[model samples]
Target: MSDTTNDTDAAGEGTATSDGDADRPTTSVEGAGEPAELDGLAVDEAVERVRAREPDRDPETVRAALGFVAEDGVVSRDALRESLKLTSKVLTTAETRVELAGIALDDAREAAESVPDLPTVEARLEDFAAEVAAVENRAAALGEDLQAVVDDRADPAARFAVADGLRQVDERAREVQRTADEIQFDLEAFERWLDSHAVRVRDLGEDLDALAASLDDLATAVDAIEAASTGDAVETAAGEAGGNAAADSDAGVDDPARAWFDATCSHRATGLTVADLRAELGDLRTWADREGADPVGEGGLDDLAARLDDLDGRHGALGERLDAAAEPEWTDRFGEAVAAVESDLADCAPPVDWGVVQSTVEEHRADIGSDA
Candidate 1:
């Protein structure tokens, strides 16, 4: 029976009892504690306790309490009412109250369309406006705190220190600017000097190169002149050889030995016995004998006279040619030498007969060949 009474109290409904006991409340006010009497505590104190404990309680503990109450089939309408009033009081003082107030006003206006309760909605709107005013006061206090922080950053001593540093930097910048100007002036002067020196050096290099080229050209001209002189000497030797061959060819018709002897005598008479002329005449006589031609006689004498005249004419022509070929400065000396040789040949006279002269020449040639 005791268990049955406890179960009835847990169910939150009055149990049927004997007599007047049925009219009495069945719940045990003892287990409910002071919190169960929702009307006894002030709404502000209740809100404060709920807010503190709710933030600290785990979700499992809250869920377990709810489940236990649900299983017991217990419902406290007064506690529920008190909790709702506490929530409204707490939200009025919250930082987001203004935003919440706006949301609540919008919700109330939307609810008015579905329900005919203008007076209730108007009362709720007035409550929201009062809460918003409190939030505005809190926001104004926060704004003042932010301004104080800003003012501390913009203090007079701090501003003065910044200004002093800026002035010093400006003065130093001007000094640096002056130094830069001086450096630029010096650089410009150095560049000008460098430009002038560069031009002079380039001109000097060009002049040196021209001088070297001219010297190279002069050297090449000298080499060409020397080569030409050597060629002339070779041609002269060849001409002498040719002349000797021609004389030998004419030997059978002339007394070459007699003519040579007479020419030598005439050269001696002029106080000029050139060894080269003598050697040439000697070579002619030897070549004639080597060819095995006839000795000289009267007919040979006539041929000899004709050959001498032909030689004289050729010598004159050679002199004229030499004069034409000679440099202006060298022509006079060359002409004089040619004239002397012609004069000596013209003055020559022979005493030996052409036959005897021919025999003597043949003997001399034999002697020279034997000696060689």
Candidate 2:
């Protein structure tokens, strides 16, 4: 009854549609025939009044009922105003939420952009792999060179005539070995340095210079030994002829078998000594070019030490063979003094003690009447 009365009163009060359309509702604004502007405080007060008047009805349902009037019905100004404010608030809140969502999307895009691209990451990984490969290859080459040097010992040279000449060659050989060892140490240090450094060609130049110098020294030492060995071979032939003449005059005619045995034994001893020296020198040359070309792995120093120990064992075995071959009969023909020298030489290890073998060969060359 109240609703009908309110609608009749509104129409009667000139709040009806201007066009007199039977299907559409008309605004409550007097002569303007349009919706009135809504006020926030006014809308709130109208909602509260509607809630109080209805007691049990929802304020939103009551506003919807009066705001969107039926055909030929009038819209309540307070209800229309309240509905407009409610819609504006909802649209504003939705717009704020959309803005916040947009900001979050922008932040996510920025974070994604900050990460390295796939190609860039792949390139870095490839660079690191290449560096590692180079280092490993270098280490592998070094180990191979070192092993080759340790195992090589198959070539022979001419005999030494003079002990002094032989000693000089031995000294030079030792110098070459010492320089090689120094280069090895430097290379190891360089490898360690590389562990913490980038592999730049310019940065490596200084170390390369030092290695080159060491290589030169090794070459020089090797050359000196070659010269000494050549010179000693010539002198040894002359000395053997002279020693034989002296022996024939002092001891009278010698037995042909005894002479043959002396020559054979002398030749064998000289051959062994010269071969060992030549092999070592040749191996040193082979090792020279490969220095610093490889990288060692973890515990490389310990591994190198173990390899050296193995080398020592090999040297010891070779020493035993040399000693066994340096028997009394073969050495005694040279003289008691030369025999003693030969014995001492045979008693020592190889590489480190190879000088002793050179000395023994010189003693034999000086006295042995051997054309063999």
TM-score of each: 0.15, 0.18
For candidate 2, list the clashing residue pairs, or say none.
138-293, 138-294, 138-295, 139-294, 139-295, 156-275, 161-236
CA shift of 107, model 2, Å: 62
Which whole-number lDDT from 0 to 100 does residue 143 have in model 2? 34
1-372 per-residue lDDT for model 2 (tens digits): 011112333212332343544333222333443332222224345344444533676666554443332122332333332332333333333333333433433343344353333332233234333433443344334334322322211101000011112223233334433433444344344343333222322233343344335334433433333343334444566587775433223222133223333433343443343433333333322332244432455423333334334444444443344344343543455345444554655654323343455566565655544532
Candidate 2, residue 233: CA error in Å? 32
| Stretches of candidate 1 exceeding 4 Å from the true structure | 1-97, 154-372
After superposition, candidate 2 runs with Cα above 4 Å error: 1-299, 324-328, 334-364, 369-372
Top candidate, metric lDDT: 2
Scored by TM-score, the top model is 2
Candidate 1, residues 1-372, lDDT tens digits: the string is 011112223222232354645543332233333232222334334333333444665444333223221212222323322322332233223324344444544554454454323332243345445544554455445334323322222222122122223233233334433433443343334233223423323333343344335334433433343344344455566687775433222222132222232333232232211222223233333433554432575433234334434444444443343333343333332334334444534433322122333454344444434322
